[model samples]
Target: MPRFAANLSMMFTEVPFMERFAAAAQAGFQAVEFLFPYDYPPATIREQLDKYGLTLALFNTSPGEVNAGEWGRSVLPGREQEAREDIDLALEYALALGCEQVHVMAGVVPQDADPEACRATFISNLRYAAERFAPHGKRVLVEALSPGVKPGYLFASQYQALAIVDEVDRANVFLQLDTFHAQKVDGNLSHLIREYAGRYVHVQVASLPDRNEPDDGEINYPWLFQLFDAVGYRGWIGCEYHPRTTTAAGLGWLAAWR
Candidate 1:
């Protein structure tokens, strides 16, 4: 089985954010990831990681005005400066916390906005980020979220994300393959992995139809893990699902994996 990383933003919510690191470590997770880390100081987060002997696997750029429904601002037409600032901020935290990868959030677009403009902005922003992160030996990642879950998300399919990856033209840029989104929008997971095996730098997991634990979902995770092994995917698998019960009680699936 592949190594698993717990998503503190989605899992282990039964405890405080600082407490989640210990919770995940105790539960046998070797690493942890989350959506955003801006709320806490980097040094504090580092202390927890060191204390628990846990690796900081991944985290995202700031989600602009999350309460207002802005998932990310990288693709927004006029927020170029703000987007770059977010990228810089993420890098600082990553450098301090020893994180190797950062996810760039492409915010929702208005229905009337020009698609070409959005694509151009996204490409430009990605190129800028890739250059900035390259010197630090860090990588940037983008994901194709399912429209059913996050409407107006820039890329909703592997093809769209891959196209952007090409446009960015940076070797350090790669796709973040989320199994839940793939099942929702693009169902052929095996073919996707075979076609784009080396393109994905990070992988996230959740159940289809509902973003819940993989154990109770219809997804054949065992087969998927086997497929990943066959494809030579040696990256960390992030558990980005919501627990049906208390986070501890809902970890039966992980117990066996550990």
Candidate 2:
């Protein structure tokens, strides 16, 4: 069976950030993940995990200046220093929380910025991050966001992300595939699962058109779940979607797995 992780950042909005850990555990999740945990000290979050016996599946490196419309810095040219800082900070939290995977966000590309230059910068930054995290036996991930969600995002397709990963040539750097974006940008879901079975380190899911629970989506998650097992994908499938109703109520789809 495929393991699932509750994305606290999106789910469990009924409570505060710290309280979501307990809510996830109470909902029968063995592992959990969130977008950014920088708001709270690692020890504090670690306490909740320890208390609830939940494992930290994955989290992202800090996105630079959200207010300024920057989603990430790794893909931004002339911002290598900031990218390095983000990686270093992420490493600190990963070690403290005993997490094994970290998603390195590829920032938005300025309209006037040269695409090739941004690609080169992203490659360099990914290599640096991979090297930094490899020593600790952690994996680095790169994800493709749909243009509708993040316009001008570095790359909006899994193939593009794979190409960049190939160029980086780092063993620890891998793709972080999201079903929502994949369905939006590239439809052949089954083909993708079979083609890149072991290449991706993490997976996320949500309903297309609405980005809600996986129970109702254009992409059949039930079939995909079986496909994941068939292809030997031993990574956590993160629940990275908005709950149409309460998170717990919408989690009926997870009943069998639980």
Candidate 3:
């Protein structure tokens, strides 16, 4: 079976951090990930990870404003200093907790931004991150946001993501595939996986249309997981979804996955 990690940051938004980790553990998850662990000290995070015996699969950099509702900004142009600080903070946390992947947050693109300039800036930043994290045995995972979310997202389609990966041109900078955004932007999953197998390093899923568990929406996760198996792709598959109700109530897909 592929390793499953709970996306504690998004999936369990209602619960406290430590309690969320405990809940994922009680539900039989051996690992969990969250975004922006900047507030919690690295020592405390290590203690929690040890207490739950949970491997840390992924985490993202600071979005500058956690409460105003920003996910991250690594790809935003003219924000190199901010991105570097965020990366360093994340590195500190990852080292303390043994995190395997740090999703290099491509921040939202500014309106009327020069496409060529933006891509160049982002790629350069990615190389900086990849080089820094490679020596530490962690990867800098780049995720493509659906264009619907932000204009000039830099990498919306699998091909676009691959282009960035190829340009970043580092073994340690890989793709982060989330089913929700992938379906929204690429509209094809299996074929994309086959075409870009080597570039992929992490996978996440939420039901189509609703962004809930697999059972709550249109996509067939059995088919999805089957495709993953067929392609011989193996890594930490995360449950990065939002709940229509409570977090626990949204997990109806667990018993349904074979």
- From the highest lDDT down, the ranking of the candidates is 2, 1, 3
Error of 1 at 65 (Å): 1.4
Each prediction's RMSD over C-alphas, in Å, is 1.1, 0.7, 2.1
**Model 2's TM-score against the true structure:** 0.99
Kindly list the per-residue Cα lDDT of model 2 for residues 88-207, writing each as its tens digit: 999999999999999999999988899999999999999999999999999999999999999999999999999999999999999999989999999899999999988898999999
TM per model?
0.97, 0.99, 0.92
Give the C-alpha lDDT of model 2: 0.94
lDDT of 2 at 50: 100
Which ranges in model 2 have alpha carbons more than 4 Å from their true place?
Answer: none
**Best-to-worst ranking by TM-score:** 2, 1, 3
Q: Estimate, for each residue in 1-258, the C-alpha lDDT of model 3 and write its tens digit.
A: 556789888777787877787788877788887766877888888888889888888888787654644456666678788888888888878888888789887765566677777778778888888888989988998888886665555677766877888888898989898888888887778778788786888999888887777665677778878788788888878888777778877666675442
TM-score of decoy 3: 0.92
The CA lDDT of each predicted structure is 0.91, 0.94, 0.79
Error of 3 at 231 (Å): 1.8
Model 1, total clashes = 1
Worst 10 residues of 1 by lDDT: 249-258
Better lDDT candidate (1, 2): 2
